[model samples]
Target chain A: MTAVAQPEPARRRTASPLARAWAFVRRNAISVFGVLALVYLLLPIVVVIVFSFNDPAGRYNYTWEGFTTEHWTNPFGPPGLGDAMEASLKVAGLATLAATILGTLAALALVRYHFRGRGATNLLIFIPLAAPEIVLGASLLTLFLNWGVSTGFWTIVIAHIMFCISFVVVTVRARLVGFDRHLEEAAMDLGANEYVTFWKVTLPLIAPGILAGALLAFSLSIDDFVITNFNSGTTVTFPLYVWGSARLGVPPEVNVIGTMIFGVAIAIMLANVLFQWRRTPKGAQ
Target chain B: MTFFHRHRWLTPYVLLAPALAWLVLFFVVPLFWLSITSLQEGTVQVGYTFTWAWENYSNAIREYHTQFFRALLYAGIATVVALLISYPLAYWIAFRGGRWKNVLLLCIIAPFFVTYLIRTLAWQNILSDNGFVLDVLKTIGLVADDGRLLATSTAVVAGITYNFLPFMALPLYVSLEQIDRSLIEAAEDLYASSAKAFLRVTLPLSMPGVIAGTLLTFIPAAGDFINAQLLGTPNQYMIGNVIQSKFLVITDYGQAAALSVLVMAVILVLIAVYTRLLGTERLAG
Candidate 1:
């Protein structure tokens, strides 16, 4: 099928100067642009990392002087950004876990069901996707206040779960659509019940997509600023802390945090790519 | 699968139950309350009560409408910019790049794997007073001796475009990749030039992605507060900032809720029209 589709274009590749130019552009454009775009994306991040060693006064007119770990080692520094960092990690960790579990469950339900109001249910899931973060944060805040719930970790977790579940549902549901039902049927035929069939058969197949979705959720929850800021009360996630610090000009310590997070994300994405490569058929390669 | 077959009516509902319940309780119910609150006029001192005030919407319509349209306008422009930047890159990755495609794709998404706030704030340092870009510009005589790029509306737009470019690119890549190569070859075989072939065949097929990417970028961009707050001054405030202020700082639930509903309704209508035009009967699905 691919042979038939690509034949004439493949043939023309050798003939037309225009085709050769197009091919050359297509071949080199991404690598050229990829490097440029990557630099564009990473330059700011690199500046942050480089300037973290600079003094607080150096923040505005930053320069790479001799290195100092003063900011890093400042346990009792002004504003205690370290405390804010710790608080951010804790909030993000809790939010990640809570969102993952709820989102995964919601994904399972959406995939397995064909019930009434399914259309409405689908719409509801996506509504949050398009929801203004400020509006969501505010609405959640009001709901919490009305219920007398305090603005803290629990509220942040709840809000994160609210927004993050849509991602899991969307991701896992797409995987589920392509997944064959016969595997579960075959498992059932071998005396597995519904729960067993789901646990042993379905879960294994959908686990990757679920993990990917959860990772996306984790990143989103941790990265969230608008919603977290609105509902956080005294709680300060990394983003909120960064926002506050930006007021007095962003602290160099925030750069250290950004660098650490970026490093971890890069490492994980690299692993994901390697894993996907390994998963593809060797014969196909 | 057999159990579902035997109990067909029960299956979908059961699958949909948890998500539906959560959506109704959290999303739909809160929206109902928001709508109700919008129609009422009362400060927190008086406690919110329905005066059936049509004036709040009218007042907001007259006063905040400019900001609302400005936000929409900015988002639209940003979305288009992102699309323009992303489409060629996406096309290169999808059709031209070979085995390096996945690696390049990984790189494109790598930035997003980190927290949004960090990435946005990173730009602060890069575009700050005599920062890297500023230093380069100054060296090139683009800015005066004491000029800065950090707080400008252009920086906000650039920041938004930089961040959302991936969202626009990925969907387009997916749609473009899904398109059969034969159609393009056929267009060429029929005596169409490379450019004409792309215009006739490639563009239409990728429209779905373009629509999805546009909606994805525009919706969030319109509602984004963090960008405006962090990157721009008071004059650059978007409707999302207003919503945040109304709901959080002021506790003006009626106006906040009203604005939320209005934005939500507008987005939904746009999405509906978009899907209809695209002939995607089950858009989210």
Candidate 2:
């Protein structure tokens, strides 16, 4: 302990007052600016949420005309948001499942083994991550046309999966790097088969990473507009619907949908924070 | 070599199979198909025959020179702006936020969870002629009585920057947080000024973040179609907008594919140079 304590006084003496002030400012700035930035980030979302309850003529300036549940209750009215919401959820859910499975499998393979062309394979996987989404979307469209496959839900799902898989692989790979391989090896040594060892030991260890990746995938799929717009013929996700509607002046109900989605995301993120906090070492927290 | 003893040969390939298969099927094959489509001369209707035309590339460059170049310019500017704005926030969050770090981090990420389209559309409400932002600006006499923020290239660029700021911040934060505190303290103890220490030590250590964040923000912003479509008219349309119009409205697959291939090539080159310069190990972290 004495060996580490020797340089402390010298370090303090040499530090300048300006440097000390800068350090103080640097440290506290996140909390200060974080509050401002947080407010900036959430302002639009909060405004949208609040305006969702306004009367139908809440266009330029939103005045609270008492309260109206008309948007949520009568979702199938003139501006039927229900259909779009349902479609978005269905597409996002399916895409999430497909991407998660594919991504997890790919991650496991890359992390656990070294193969010929591993470098090339790594590049290929990350290519999707780095590729401009517009290029990817256009390429997929062209490929589909050349193969004579009409654009539909399947095409959208496939496109979503293509992008989402990379995220899954990237997230899971990070977890796998710090992972101890000994547990699986020990399981195999104790008469467990390869599959059993993986199932019993490896799967549980990587489950949190998988969940994080899956949540990310789900959000990406839900929030996608460009690729989904390209592939869906007459189909519309919530974003697409919102975009189309904004051309004719945005209805207040769209704000309601936005608010609901924002609320759900906040809930999920808060839960994630709590879950992580519980899992963290007490000292670290 | 004993075949039975060399189970390593099988293990690596087995582990890598799924990822390799996915990359080949979705990414590589699709890219090759797009390339082939680009080389063809005709539209999709007359059954695009192989023509091996190099004219498409030159034509794309000739016809959309301004839009293409403008897209790149906007992307570059937005990326730089986001980086400039995000660095201090990311730096504070990473090195100095203390116990509120994770909570603040969540706040940074929370905006991303909302549907991107909705967020941008909300900006419309804020920036509309009689909207809050415009009203505030007018009150301070920043514009004429009719000055508007929407339907302009600046709005599209600003929107892109606003949405993508987190991508820049997170990667930068990750890189900055990974920096050793001892290095900074060591410089201080050696009687180096804070500004000197930051320039010599902090900036160099954070190069990986700058590279990754720039790539992450710039690539997407370059090809962003929705921002132009929603916020700006034909004059502000980007390369991505052109690609979409070609494939969907114009039904010009050859031109679309050619455009896509050009972007893919450009991005790939960027990635190669970036990875080479920054080294993937650092950026990947």
Candidate 3:
């Protein structure tokens, strides 16, 4: 009280260390929270990976018993696992190919041209994404029932493609929008035909976008359950197999496969990120 | 030399034809078919007929109002939780992150690439009665020994939040990343506190992402039944479970179709109100 702010000065000089520490905490609190949120996001994944090594005493792989690598070594030793994997791969491959081709073309048109029904096309592309997937599954099933089309492997593929096309279009369109049109114009001016220009210039430029879209479609189709469950009459995809088994009991093999999928997916994603970083200029990063 | 130059107006149509045909046959037509089926009397063995059964809607609303309310409430809560968690995370990745942004973002999303079913099942294990989560909670006197998380609404909502968190994070990241850094600097220059600058400047700019992310999370979460099926008891059953069982188990096609239509309508109305309340012109621009 002797000075105007002797207490404040003394506190800052000596006893304000606790307050300084709190100020530091307050400043970086959001960053710590962010990383903690990420850790929370990864917790279940960690659990899935951890249980892959668990040797369950019972049929249900709920409690931890002992550690074993048997499931990892023989992932498909469980009955129906091979069939489920094959069905999933076959459907995912076919749907991704078809959806990518169709969606790339649609994305190009939507981005490059001033056309009739452009707004309508945008709305149409958006509606599938906006609608609940249950509605899509129910609606498609109803159509199939009315038309008497048998539901099975092909039906699952059809349903996957139907839902995936919208996602593909959006992904490709995002890439298409950012690209410079001058490059394509230069190609055309350099005595390149339309087909050659597309194959040589435009296609290469849009290839990454197409690849990303294809990857997205593949994952969506492979991991789909609710829609697949409705459209698949007896076709047991990996998710369907998992669902059926979960009702009774789940094998450790499921965790093994899940861990493998997660690992492979991460590898692919990191590679893609590397590829993008290389393609973009050094200045951007 | 030019595809668009030669074909002029016809080019866009040609590009769009395949996707449009597929969407029309599988998506648009199926939805129309669903509406007709919703009005028809239906049975699995007897075959459905066009009998104008409006009672299907009335009966669904009367019979399943609680399930509807439960689904909406669970999804709503999950969306808010996801937003709260994602905002800080996305903000950090966008601004505070240096060269590690892409790597950090990839790590955050890598877990989601695992099969959806297996991950949800992982949640079942994580929240099991005698699991570490419960042990810690009980140790801290936060949970009674007899009060379990599994087979409860809490488990179901947690599953929803985990499953849809990435959907919220990605969009929020995109928006937060696109903000101009200089604007925040300008606010600081005007003697605004860090928190005030963030609240006044950063938050307003990120509203579009908030809208997009919330819609993406809420719409899918509301329609998802796997979480309820795997993690919660019958008491926590959602409308998705009701609709799924109706279509698959009971084969009450008309009522399921009606429920689908009603759910779609309600979601659409909700989206309209949401975008209106937030003012969509800003989002669109």
Structure candidate 1, residue pairs in collision: A113-B12, A114-B12, A115-B12, A115-B13
Shift in Å, residue B77, candidate 2? 0.8
- DockQ, ranked from best to worst: 3, 2, 1
Better DockQ candidate (2, 3): 3
- Candidate 1 lDDT, tens digit per residue, A171-222? 8778878999989899999999888988899989999888888787877877
Best candidate (score: TM-score): 3
Is candidate 1 or 3 superior in DockQ? 3
For each candidate, what is the lDDT?
A: 0.75, 0.80, 0.89
Q: Each model's RMSD to truth, in Å?
A: 3.6, 3.5, 5.3
Which number leads on lDDT?
A: 3
Model 3 global lDDT (CA atoms, 0 to 1): 0.89
DockQ of 1: 0.48
lDDT of 3 by residue, B1-285 (tens): 375687688988999999988999999999998999899985777788888899999999999999999999999999999999999999888877766788889977876788999999999999998689999999899988788999999999999999999999999999998888777766755766566888999998999889999999999999989999999988999999999999999999898999998888999999999989885776654
lDDT of 1 by residue, B1-285 (tens): 787768767765665566566666666666666777788878988777778877888887787987798788889889988888788778877875565678888767767755677778767657777467888888899987788788888888888888787888899989998888877777776778777888888888888899889988988888887788878887888888888888878888887778877888788888888779774743443
Q: Name the regions of candidate 1 deviating beyond 4 angstroms.
A: A1-10, A13-31, A58-66, A69-83, A146-148, A281-285, B1-12, B138-148, B277-285
Q: Which ten residues in a row have the lowest lDDT in candidate 1 chain B?
A: B276-285
Highest DockQ scorer: 3
Ranking by TM-score: 3, 2, 1
